[model samples]
Target chain A: MHEHIQPVALEKAYRLLNHGPTVLVSSHHDGVDNVMAAAWACALDFAPPKLTVVLDKATKTRELIEKSGRFVIQVPTVKLLRLTHEVGTRSLANEPSKLQDTGVELLHLAGDTLPFVAGCSGWLECRLVPEPHNQATYDLFIGEVVAAWADDRVFYDGHWHFETAGREWGSIHHIAGGHFYAIGEQMSARPKRGG
Target chain B: MHEHIQPVALEKAYRLLNHGPTVLVSSHHDGVDNVMAAAWACALDFAPPKLTVVLDKATKTRELIEKSGRFVIQVPTVKLLRLTHEVGTRSLANEPSKLQDTGVELLHLAGDTLPFVAGCSGWLECRLVPEPHNQATYDLFIGEVVAAWADDRVFYDGHWHFETAGREWGSIHHIAGGHFYAIGEQMSARPKRGG
Candidate 1:
């Protein structure tokens, strides 16, 4: 499949996460790469567009990310819903190689040599900000977007267009008990006037 | 309004965040309390029901939470949508008290002294699990749910019945520019057969 990488103004980078979709954290080290599904990520700051993600102490993705100093978060499409669950619960620690177990397709975008899940709608390639305290105590990793890209067909001009896409492009919000909530019913609220 | 506080098993607490709704962080210090809206809150654990939230250093709510060692996360209903944006951008640090500016009705649940915003669908009252490193570096706070309660009118048996009698009890998921999405459309996918 073909792809394009757009330069999202650092200030606008927060828009990627403002919607709160469960994402796959992808990392590469020593020519090996892996992706793990994470439902615990949020926009931590604007202007510079920073994000904080929780990488568990036991996950191989965290180890690889620490060694490589870079990781990419891919917003998985609806078609990969089951795959998201597979990656989230399976431990890379248990299996030396997860890519061998989970059959999820992979894609490489932009300057991100790290491989991303093929069915994702957007990708944020991040460089680790090295918050040792947050990482050790809270499993929180802060990153600054080095490069960002999205499937323009779905996300463009700062708005996620889920109407045109099929489940393969629909974002997944995972609830517990193996259930997930697809981004549903769109509505916009104007800012309340003059408090 | 009549309300009930039911105990939710710790393992299932992630359901509170599964839909990704913006929340009001309420805290009290020496009898002075404050509430602020946070669009960036997410689940960090399942078994222990840990949560990760960002509390700006400049905010009074943060100070109170640090001093009091507790805070409550209240998931507001669609009815409270009008007041969501008001608390987020306006800091209690400037105003003498947030309660005055927000005009949001507050109720103190039994067993927990922190105020919870009435009309909200659920409430998670947590004790600060201080990680000084994470706090000093990223302004990220981690809390373990010591007590949790939900308005059963909306949540029961592990799912939100917004379409039923609790129609207006849907949780508010905010995107950007004040545009919010009420938790819509719920689907259940049974876990695939045993490996």
Candidate 2:
């Protein structure tokens, strides 16, 4: 792990994904490692943090996750935009060298065999909460976050510091077809003024 | 509908939420209408679009959705920041006049009874898909978008025009509490340069 990487309290893990940034989902199975970009991941619960990510049946990363029953959902910074899109478009099934070709450098978190993509603002290590109906019908997978970490330069004290972190550290939100928007200026709402 | 509000193609409706903006969810049942803010809504599929939103069991809007079997998920703009936080915090169950107190103006879509917040950038009228187990266990609700529309000034031609739509029109993404970040700069990746 990088010196800047720090563990996030499991209780506050949902905050890492609250703002809805496009995430990189990585998994390892049978000596195989894979990563792919997903725009449809969302925080599903708070305590005993759970999240949902839609993994298309076609992606090799999804197959790895099904076999390994563990995956890492990482918030990729603006600097990784090209890498994110490349991994999303290319398939590990067709291109066996996809990860290396896309310039993905994997970093391990101690004892875990799960592959974590470096340079992301945050990483959530999740154990697959198997929901067969959702997976077979909707391609939706649920995971209970067992552990989480953040690159404190961009996220710390249980919140994201995108404004202070340089533009390259901004989390990217994908709309479609290689297009994305980096998270922008922060605004605070006035306390319960009415209603 | 406002002059700028135009119907969005059903196939392109998923693009409206692909960027993951904080949305205003509204529902009507038994002569009552209510709206609440949700940061956890995400597009589930395309081509007869489907979406998922987390509605706490405590929310009155969720109750209405359960009874009526329909709800509207609208992407709110920066202009509605205060309203968004206000509604999300104040429950209609306790505050009988929550909508009016928060200055929410409910607009109707032709014959539809669902209340659409007036100033949102996009509206996705959804039919509850009724995943009872998931809803009960995870407070996760799935909705298939039946009809969709977007304010052409901010979103049109199947894309978000945040840069050209002015700052106030930008989509707001909730972080936690009353804090949020607006959708920022638009970016496009250079087509497939790597392996």
The number of the candidate with the highest lDDT is: 2
Best model per TM-score: 2
Tell me model 1's lDDT, rounded to 2 decimals: 0.77
- Provide TM-scores for the models: 0.88, 0.97
Which regions of candidate 2 deviate over 4 angstroms? Answer: A191-195, B192-195
Best by DockQ: 2
Q: List the residue pairs that clash in candidate 1.
A: none
**TM-score attained by chain A of model 2:** 0.96
Q: Distance (Å) between predicted and true CA of B171, model 1?
A: 2.0
**Model 1 alpha-carbon drift over 4 Å, by segment:** A1-5, A92-97, A163-168, A191-195, B97-101, B110-112, B162-167, B189-195
Q: Model 2, A59-97: lDDT tens per residue?
A: 998899999899999999999999999998999999999
What is candidate 2's lDDT per residue for B14-116, written digit by digit as tens? 9889988999999999899999999999999997799999999999998999999999999999999999999999998999999889999988974668899
Q: State the C-alpha lDDT per candidate.
A: 0.77, 0.93
Chain A TM-scores, per candidate, are 0.90, 0.96
Report the alpha-carbon TM-score of model 1 versus the true structure: 0.88
